[model samples]
Target: MTRRWTDAALTAVAPTTWGTTYLVTAELLPADRPLWSGAIRALPAGLLLLALTRRRPHGVWWGRAALLGALNIGAFFPLLFVAAYRLPGGTAAVLGAAQPLLVAVLTVALLRDRPGRPALLAALAAPAGVALVVLRPGAGLDPLGVAAGLAGTAAMAAGLVLTRRWGRPPGVGTLAATSWQLVAGGLLIVPVAAAVEGAPPAPDGPALLGYAWLGLAGTALAYALWFRGAARLPVTRVSVLGALSPLTAATLGWLVLGQALSPTQLTGFAVAVAAMVFGQLPDRAARGRRADQPARGQRVGRPAPGRQVEQQAHGRHVGQPARRRLVGQPARGRLVGQPVRRRLVGQPARSRRQASAGASAATPSGSAPGGSSAAAASGSVNRCAADGAAA
Candidate 1:
């Protein structure tokens, strides 16, 4: 449990560092080159990680790595930049806030997992809290930007779920897997950046510093930690941590840019924090309910102790052998090899008594004159019937 929270905190660092992207781009990076900027951020980090890991994907992992890269970084980064450029920052953030909810739905559809009630509520509450923190009055809504933002959110959400689903290939570390994705995603973006933005701009010292931070810490380290947690933790839980991005952005604006926060923003901050924290907690009720369930292939209930012998005797419970009579003992109310004798329905009582006396007199010693065993078996059957009646 402690390890789970640790992984969550480590994973959270990715988005928290991401919160600084707006500030970094506005203050440090070259202007009017968002595509080139994304390419720089991804390509160098990926190359650096590849150099360090010295491992490559094999077989199906090659295709899997490309798909994950496209969703997580290649397509997502371009769409995100488009949204940020075309829409108001507030509106873009509010749209991106829908990621947790998207992840929840996709988890059910793709992974067949039902998130707990708390997780579902958190998914709804996270977007509302983010809207409060980042949304502004009369924020302009561009159709293209809205579409891009939603697409980016969906892409990232799908990437997150798929990351959890596929996980790291055998014997490959998180760093290696992250490197594969970054490299694949970076390679994909290079052509688009070159086509759209023409040549890369010469970076000044501050721009170089900014690129290094975004590449090494933001892209490489951040994604490595993110994938590690995704492999170890629930996807919904990890996606909820994305709410921290806007909250962190808002905080940086206040501290670094001298922006002031209103009471409503502060309230929203508290609510977002509360929702993220609540989402992290283990669902004890869900765990308890799962614990109460019977394991697969197990019987639901056991027979009563008193009925076990009878059931076993009839080959009903454990398929034991049928009950056997003891030597010289009778079954039911008759000797083992003898036919049952019955009196006529309307026979007189006196006649019945006389017949019984005659049979007993013939076996005075409780044994027939020539067939002692038959007489003994008959006596035993009669005793057994009387005992059964008493019982």
Candidate 2:
């Protein structure tokens, strides 16, 4: 338990910082220049990472890195900006909250990965939790914003699955891989930002600070932690942690803006946090494996060293439970319905009484355990003994 939490600590950094993205966008960044903000956030950070690492994508990795970056950053950044700007923060948040579900579904469809019930339920439950935290009676959702939000969610989900599937190449570190994606994503962002918004005024002090923080902490550091987590942990587990982002956004809104959190908001906050924590738990299959393994001090089977020797000594494997043996009975391992009509060694094997009794005990029709050799072996011995006594 401690170990899982400790390992997830870096992954936790990404979403926790991301929670502030909404806050920074709303409070600090200039209006009508979200694309500019995204570009500034990603490009420089990516370049800095590239400069620091001095590594480049090799061979087919160039294409793979581009695709990943486009999904996670290029398309995702612009769409996310639209969602943040056009929709009520909570409405956008609810849309963002659906990311885990998309990731879980895509993993199942593409990777053939099955998420445990807890992770699935937590993912399904997150939107409701976010709605609770941020939704108000007057919170109106915009169609364009909703579409953008969904698209961004999908883009990020696809990127996450790919990150887990095609991990960092040999000799390339996690930071280097992160830099590759960022550089590609940032480059993609460049033309789009210019074409759509043309060029925005030079960023003022607050906007500049926001851009610096986003580039340094949010984009570079956050993605480094994200790919690191995805590389090591199950994709579903890492995705579930994203619930923290909306929760963080809501808490920041309440505190930073001095807006009071209502009773319902508080309840929603607790639920969201609880769901994220619960979703990180090991799946049922993992838990079952751990449970089935015997304690180190106890012996459930033969020693690992002696298992092969034991198998060699006996024609049968030692691990398999031995079948019960009937005394003085033929060791043929099949169920006998009745005495054979043919003679054995030119003499009848059993008397008429034995055939009649054998037929009475078991019918010709038989299955595995229900009508198997077990019943025939014991029944035959008892009937033969009874006949001998009667004689």
Residue pairs with colliding backbones in model 1 are none
Top-TM-score structure, candidate number: 1
Please list the C-alpha lDDT of all candidates, in the order they appear.
0.80, 0.79
Superposed Cα deviation of residue 35, candidate 2 (Å): 1.2
lDDT of 2 by residue, 1-391 (tens): 7767876777988988988999999888999887877888888999999999999999989999999999999999989899999998888888888989999999998889788887888897777788898888987778999999999999999999999999988999988999988989999998888998998558889988999899999999999999989988888878888878888888888788887889998888878878887888888786797688976775676555434432311243444554444564543433354232211222222454475455546655342123445544344443321122211
Q: How far is 355's C-alpha from truth in model 1 (Å)? A: 58
lDDT for residue 310 in candidate 2, whole number 0-100: 28
In candidate 1, what are the lDDT values of residues 49-106, reduced to their tens digit?
9999999999999999999999999988878877877887768878888998999999
Model 2: pairs clashing at backbone N, Cα or C within 3 Å: none
- TM-score of model 2 (CA atoms): 0.75
